[model samples]
Target: MSVSPEAIRSALLARREIALIDVRQEALFALGHPLFAAQIPLQRIALEAPWRIPRQNTPIVVYDDGEGLAEPALHQLRALGYTQADVLEGGLAGWKAAGYELFEDVNSYSKAFGELVEHRRHTPSLPAPDVLALIEEKADIAILDARRFDEYATMSIPGGRSVPGAELVLRAPVAAPDPDTTIIVNCAGRTRSIIGTQSLINAGLPNRIFALRNGTIGWTLAGQALETGRQESVEKGEGSGHDLARERARDVAYRAGVRRIDSADLKGLIADSDRTLYRFDVRQPADFAAGHPAGFRNAPGGQLVQETDHFAPVRGARIVLVDDLGSRADMTASWLAQLGWEVLVLADAFDGPLETGDDGAPPPRGPHGRYKRPYEGTDNREAAMQAYLDWEYGLVAQLERDGTHGFFVI
Candidate 1:
């Protein structure tokens, strides 16, 4: 028997755990789906299910938009040892017929959550022209790109250095040692820039800070040129101000209700057959490859926040984050907690031995179902970019109507 759309919505509103997965190409899933639906393409479920939905008995509801993919997907899941798998009754059509809301774009919830954060916190931002003027005058300022290294390398602000989201609190001191220097954080578009800037202010950084409004898209619209082939990045080791940043991050985590746990506590969480748990190391990919505790996968803290659905498909799951440096995990856990996750940070430093390798994430597949993000890349139609921003502005109201996201800003 299949699960009904109303049942899934009821579970979500009640904060119960369920994996309402969309087993279609990402593009199709992105076009429209319920707010909490996670896309796990039918072609990749076998490769991804083991880790992405780790627990065998997780309440799994797979659906497809009249594509006849759900049944096969359910079969593969059961063959792989999943016991509570079922199809979403009537598939995507059933969801629509039930008069429920469908969200667009990939990582929809995180994007919506980011909008909620800015809406509630009034995250500060400066228009591109003003920032450009500051830079042209050689003002005492630092531009840190809060994106992946590869994305930063593709194109960046002329003087910007890569200091991805999770790394901001950990490395801001080294990036801009002078307390008086102004700090600007930016991404391809608004979300990361807003989150990164707010993160520093929340962490009690003394430097004056602002997000470059609308990010690179805003800069491009204003006819300002972005520099390409930039390789500057934050230094890898613990910076001089690590202690201060760590303390501030811990405080933020505490305020957001994130718990600090040790190995013994973690063992109990793992043994709890009643709940699903996701373990990740919220450090840079390179740092994770160097060594990490067993069973923890690498998820750079910033991206983890941006792509929570992709990393942890099951809603209402318990998440445990690890970082040798306390601040990175604490900062990430703070955001996770606000996103309504039962998140905790591991305080113990591993002593005995650790596993070393890549994060074991699935290899990238063809762009068959990939959604084209207008904010990405240097060349995008101006109308599409503006429309993307417009879509984001309306998310807060839609979230209110959806009434399933239990997020709270701290």
Candidate 2:
């Protein structure tokens, strides 16, 4: 049976079982999407679906942005063993017409909260050009690229240190030993920059910290010069256990009005013989590559939480998380758990492992040879830059409608 926008809206509001899939490219989905809808480009469905959804018979509803794509997607899923697959009645436009909220930009809620935090805390940040000039003049600013090390090696602002996203909180103080040293966090785009800066802010570091405005994307777009390097020095820490972190995360969840579930409750739900259960290992590709649980697949934590619908389109499905360390899995799980998912953090398999670099790595840059973001649609022949900005502007309201964001200050 085809799903109507009204039905989808009701299901979302009631927090019922349903997976609303947007069979569009990542770029288009990023432009704007229903709060709970996940973006799984039609092309990657074959490769990603079984890994993400797992259940051959899960009820799956696919939609597109008024484009004639969902029909083919429905056929595709049916062929792939999704017996209950169907299409959304109106695509995204229909939902918009129904007055349901649409979120814009990638990581809408997290990015908005970042902006909110910056405004509320009056957090400091340096514009790309200013930061560039300071570097050229041998100024005091310590430019730390708060992204993955490999991303930094591809392209970076001259002299920026490679600090991976997760390590920022644990390693920032060491990066700038003196409290007086100015610290700047940056990623390929805005999310990590904001998140990295806030990580230090949350950690209660004494130094002045700021996110490099707009991150490396803004830097590259503005025609700023960049440097390439592979050498990185970042100190790593031991895993803080799930049990301890969960209790602490639970407090954070409680403050954000999120709920927690025990392993027993989760297992009982997993035992349900009729449903699909998806366990996502929301850590970096490198971490996932090293070792992960048997049933769990890799989807980075930040992106997983932000684009949950895309990852686990099967609504009401069980989602268990695995992380090598506690903060990322805990933080991401907190958001998803609050969103009314049966979320849990499985204990890390590795404790006190040999550390990786401590320097802030730059954001993933150049071409991700492994996974090209699908929705970054083929550059429109006639699309203007402003269209991109407009898409980002609308995402703020989308985050509001999604509700249960479960993010907060530390």
Among these predicted structures, which one has the highest lDDT?
1
The lDDT per prediction is: 0.91, 0.64
What lDDT tens digits, residue by residue, belong to model 2 across residues 1-410?
Answer: 68888887677666566777878877677667766666677877776777667777777789998789999888888889988888887778777788877776554555566554565566677888888877778866667776666668877777788776655554565677688888988876565676667656654567888888766656755677667665765554334433443344445444434434445565675788686677666667776766665556677765665456656776777677766655566666655664557666666434334334221222322342123432232232223334443454444454565553433443
Off by over 4 Å in 1: 236-240
**Stretches of model 2 off by over 4 angstroms after superposition:** 25-32, 65-67, 101-123, 133-141, 220-223, 229-233, 237-266, 272-277, 302-310, 314-318, 334-342, 348-394, 397-410
- Could you tell me the lDDT of residue 243 within candidate 1? 78
Give the per-residue lDDT digits (tens) of candidate 1, residues 281-345: 98998889999999898899999999999999999999999988788899999999999999999
> Model 1's lDDT to the true fold?
0.91
Clash tally, candidates in order: 1, 24
Model 2: number of backbone collisions? 24
lDDT, candidate 2, equals: 0.64
